[model samples]
Target: MVKPVNVGIVGCGAISAAYTTTIARLAGLRLTAVADLDAARARATAEANGTRALSVAELLADPDVDIVLNLTIPAAHADVALAAIAAGKDVYGEKPLATTKAEALQVLQAADTAGARLGCAPDTVLGTGVQTARWYVDNGLIGRPVAATAIMNHPGHERWHPNPDFYYTPGGGPLFDMGPYYITALITLLGPVSKVIGAASRTRSERTIVTGPRAGTTVPVTTDSHVTGILIHDSGALSTLVMSFDSAATRAPNIELHGEQATLHLPDPNHFDGEIHAHPVGGTWTSLPTRAGYQDAARGYGLADLTTTPPTQLPRTSAALALHVLDIMESLLTSTTTGQATALTTTCDRPPPVPLGPLEPRTE
Candidate 1:
């Protein structure tokens, strides 16, 4: 029997709970410690999850911690990841990788130099929904891919999130927060992006919180609330993206792929499992069976993938791919400023596909 990887988690916030839950269930991972800037919160989460509570520094240095599960906010992602890499531990974190490409590049450099494996979230792709869709495309169910569309629209996070001020900040907007899932899925299906043209709008300068104890509090909006862009994939496929926090509603499909012979309606990229429907030429839209990816996967599946990947190779949700996603997003925003199609400076090979079944113990 293989010994489970000891995971020390940093940032005991809302997302940490999901990771803790997943770690508990996945056979090859064990939650060993937890840390948060708020000691009380750290202690509470650790006690609840049957782990030790440590200061962030102590957790980083913990001898038992084989991997650092970083759930810190976007602004601190690079800092925490760098610290983990410096301590010679593999690291996985929630996405956007970092607020800016420059910072993200540094994290990538640090990991490469330290020979520490780095991975990032939006592992939702490793689940049945998107993977089944990718399988269809790869299997020629959608013949000769041409164009795609991805849309995500909502009022705003202030309606539900207690501390949503960060959502309006430079690193938070619709594109940064939600674009990763859609764009990453697109890349997985179509291939890497080469250039992009974007147009964006900030519908409101400030927003009022409508939930939690901070209800009625006003927060400044420094980033665009509505973002739309066209990604020119290296394979010559074009993906139209519409991500907006300003919209009250949208009827557009969450994601759709077009080809010479068919059109496919894909499940939401943010979810683990959902129906994938495909419409072939002169045929009715039909559902495709879950054909690829891990079954019943969850948020921390990437951490499981990271810990189990061979030391000589990167994980499917690798830092290289996350950095590429970040570059595409940052380049889109830059295009909004310059009013010209911006060419991407970074590109990554689509990581290997996940086979069906549990990621940890193989089923005979």
Candidate 2:
């Protein structure tokens, strides 16, 4: 049996709640400690979850900790991940693994040197919704996935997120922030990207935060606030991806895979459970069969089939999933700097996506 692992949380922020709740419910995982730059935040998070708070140093130093969930922002993701890996812990963090490809490389290096596993998110792909889509596409139910498209458009999160300034800055653009979920989900349904041709712009020089007490505070945009890209995946599938902070509205599905036979509908990127709808070429929509009661729900990181054979645990988009995403980020950033298409190493590592069984029918 795989031994149960002690888990730690490094950043106490808004998104931290989901990680903590998920960790609490899953077996083979235990929330051993929590930490933050602000001790009070850490304490509050721990208290809410019936746990203890440790300082950043103490949490990393604890021998009992096995997995450190890096809940820090895009800017702090790599640094926190590197520190955790060095301290002999497996790690998974939020996306665009680091601020730049260089920082991401350092994270991979740390994981490699320590022989501790590394990964990052948009774990949403591992959810039942995406996995079911992966199954149908790989099985030729869609008859060769020729292309994909994903779009995320919402006013900035400033009103709700207390520390929203960073999200409007360079490392926090739409592609860097919201792009990971769509990108990671697509890569899961397809495979790694080989190249990206980007054309981006800042529609607005500034955005005013609308949700919080700081609602009226204006934040400057230093990078591309609206990003559009055409990606060629190693799987021979092409994608049109869009992310923006300024769009008042967008009708694009979070993601859709267009294949020779049908189009598959996907769920939102932030959650794991939902319906996977298939629209046949000459027909209409139908729900694909899946494991009963498992819609949108998925296995956590320790469960993804990582070794290329049958996975011992249920299929999950866990830590390994995050690393695959980091590989994509490295290549996207490289293309931005080198002005040349760069291939991701993940193209070589990931096996063809395994297909999901048809959703089983339920009896009254």
Leading candidate by TM-score: 1
Q: Mind giving the per-residue lDDT tens digits that candidate 1 earns over 1-364?
A: 8688889999999989888999999878899999999999999999999889999999998999999999999999999999999999989999979999999999999998998889998899999888888888998988999999999999999999999988899999999999999999999899899999999999899999999999999999999999999999999999999999999998889999999999999888999899999888999988888899899899999889888888788889988899999999999999999999999999999888877787874222
lDDT of 2 by residue, 4-118 (tens): 5678889998878877776666555678899999999999999999988999999999998877888887788888988898888877676767887667768877777887666
Score every model by TM-score: 0.98, 0.86
lDDT of 1 at 176: 94
Candidate 1 CA-lDDT value:
0.92
TM-score of 1: 0.98
